[model samples]
Target: MIDPVIIRTMKTVKEIRLENARALANEGPAEFARRIDSSTQQVNQFMGPSPTRNIGDKLARRIEAAFGKPEGWLDVEHITGSDDASISGTRSAVLEKLLPEGSGNLVTWETPDDLEPDDERVWIDRYDYRYSAGNGVIQWEVRQKKALPFDIGFFKALGVRPQDCKLAQVHGRSMEPYLFNRDMMMICTAKTRVKDGLIYAVTFEDEPLVKQIFKEPEGALRLHSYNPEFPDKIIAADQLEGLQIAGEVVYRSGSGLAGGN
Candidate 1:
């Protein structure tokens, strides 16, 4: 048996991810690409620079590109690098300054002519998004350090950006015995909006759930749990503040599934 809390949280988390995989399978390349593009823009706008971190111009462009728009931007027509953005060159140039190739500790590299810029890998240690259950919009957000009451080293590899390739974590026990707590979920993070029957991050009253999301007859969302013992909950669009669908959970591994890692 898993910690009920972990189980509770991770179950919802996995539900969101599984739903994503199904959706991607259904969409065509063009439609899928468009969705990814929109997602990228939303991330860039919301997760800018973070604390004390500067959003390098190249990475910005690369992030925008990952979503599949133009090389510089997906939502906007302009190529990256306004006068302020163009201040420095690409990663090779930037890394050389901070990393100092001579320091054997860090990988050494010189910029090749074809070298392109990109975002750092962001591992899905845990999902920490917040929303109002009564009105689920991403009203607030947290990350591994904030929401996770445990230590997850996955962050060492990825740093919470598109370059990280995007990942999510399972966070409930709705799907008991199958998905437990702190399960690192691999998500494409290319989805923009919410879809029915897919597990997603939903705000319930004031808490965010990594729950499997289904549509209700009343046009509200029905958050379901696998255990059956747990009551299936319904959340109308009007009742929600907003929704943050963290793509779909593609991979599951971590404390809950693999036996207390």
Candidate 2:
């Protein structure tokens, strides 16, 4: 028989590992494993919270390196810190240590304003894909592209590169009153995981949509709308064909487009 105490410890450690992984990359197992140069099956099996599997020291070091964590970060058995009732305690503590001050709210994905002088800035391209947020009224084509420069600290804090982002504008009411029409959104093309309750830009049925996606227990995707006037749409697992997820909506600006800083 399996030891219950060992099983409990395994579950706790695995949960922490998963939490750190999500905080660092916000990616699915496959992409995370790829970034770590590991296999998806190994990551899933070793990191599954319910499984009583131990992460070897070698693999632990790999995870720490992949997440840009300090050595021995994954060796701890128990973590202690302030716990916010409304947010994740582990995530907050881990991020607090890694990110600069004023970058507290991870859910909102805000970066600190006082970035170090050594932080570099790079210009990235904004494609011509106008994904409609209301109805399918805009053309989804790559045209009239332009490049904008952004500070690297903003993306480094999120474990992403500026080149992995796209500058897009919201153009419909289906996503309002949160993301209004003509609002600017910084979409992270690399963060492809369909995490629950997070906003994403996806091409559904050859049409673009900006909505919150929730993975149902039965494996269907529930496209949710912030406005109560719009009904939630469901897409079965089998019907997920041609669903190209543009990326997670990291930042939004109701004022105007993000300019060079």
Candidate 3:
């Protein structure tokens, strides 16, 4: 016998999740996406206004930067963060912390950023791949959203678990002729062993960069740029944080090059 009250409660929760998902796709700002007017109203709707946009807020910014521009509360739920808003937290919350190490990849796919709301694809996949996102949370039917033909960001972080993250979008042409501006690349974040030659994502002087990797003896990691014009950057293996191979470039997309523009 189905309990009507329990079913109603489940429906309410599902409705909220779906409504928020829709808003997220349309507005690109989870907290501000609800057109309910007034900050207080928005806070009440979300149940937590955020203390000056701290952890969850920071993760939301990253989600917008990495995936699609924010969208709904639940959309940000499974992104990069320690709270329910982050991808990790969302799955943990609904799945009740069932995320184990070495699970499948967790890439986020979504509808195009410029698509119109009425466009059947308005609901993008932006974050968390089909397999990971469906671990046991969202219903099987609701999981049918297929982002655009442009799903991407595989590389090292594609499906690499929570701890190990080697991800950074390419900037400048220093590694040019090979990797131009806006070209995204990922490296293994584990920093396991600085083998001989493995490209890594390097952060030097607070500046993040992606370049070919090389590790030398005496505990020193080297960075070799493909563009002959740019000189190589080197640092000690222990100091590898600045020269660690976050992950390798597994997939690239955008424009029209398959990964396109």
lDDT values, one for every candidate: 0.44, 0.66, 0.42
Reference-based TM-score, model 3: 0.34
Instruction: Decide which is better by TM-score, 2 or 3.
Output: 2
lDDT of 1 by residue, 69-132 (tens): 4553322322234552243234224434544544423122342223333343222334443323
List, residue by residue over 1-261, the lDDT tens digit for candidate 2: 986663333546555665555544446567878889977556655543332355667777888888788887775533344443234555455445654354422221124333333447675666545654334333345444655557688788766678778878777788776788877777887877888888888888777788989998678999998878889989988887757678888877674333211
Q: Which ten residues in a row have the lowest lDDT in candidate 1?
A: 44-53
Show the lowest summed lDDT stretch of 10 residues, model 2: 104-113
lDDT of 3 by residue, 1-261 (tens): 986663323334334443343334333234443333334323323333121222244434443454355444443333323453464344335332333333322323253554434322222232221111122222112233443332233322345443343223455767665567666443344554545565555455444566666657787756787678889877875674443233454344322133211
Model 1 stretches astray by more than 4 angstroms: 1-172, 187-192, 240-247, 255-261
Q: Estimate TM-scores for all models.
A: 0.36, 0.47, 0.34
Which ranges in model 2 have alpha carbons more than 4 Å from their true place?
A: 1-119, 131-140, 255-261
Best-to-worst TM-score order: 2, 1, 3
Top model number, lDDT: 2
Q: Which stretches of candidate 3 lie over 4 Å from their true place?
A: 1-168, 186-193, 237-245, 254-261
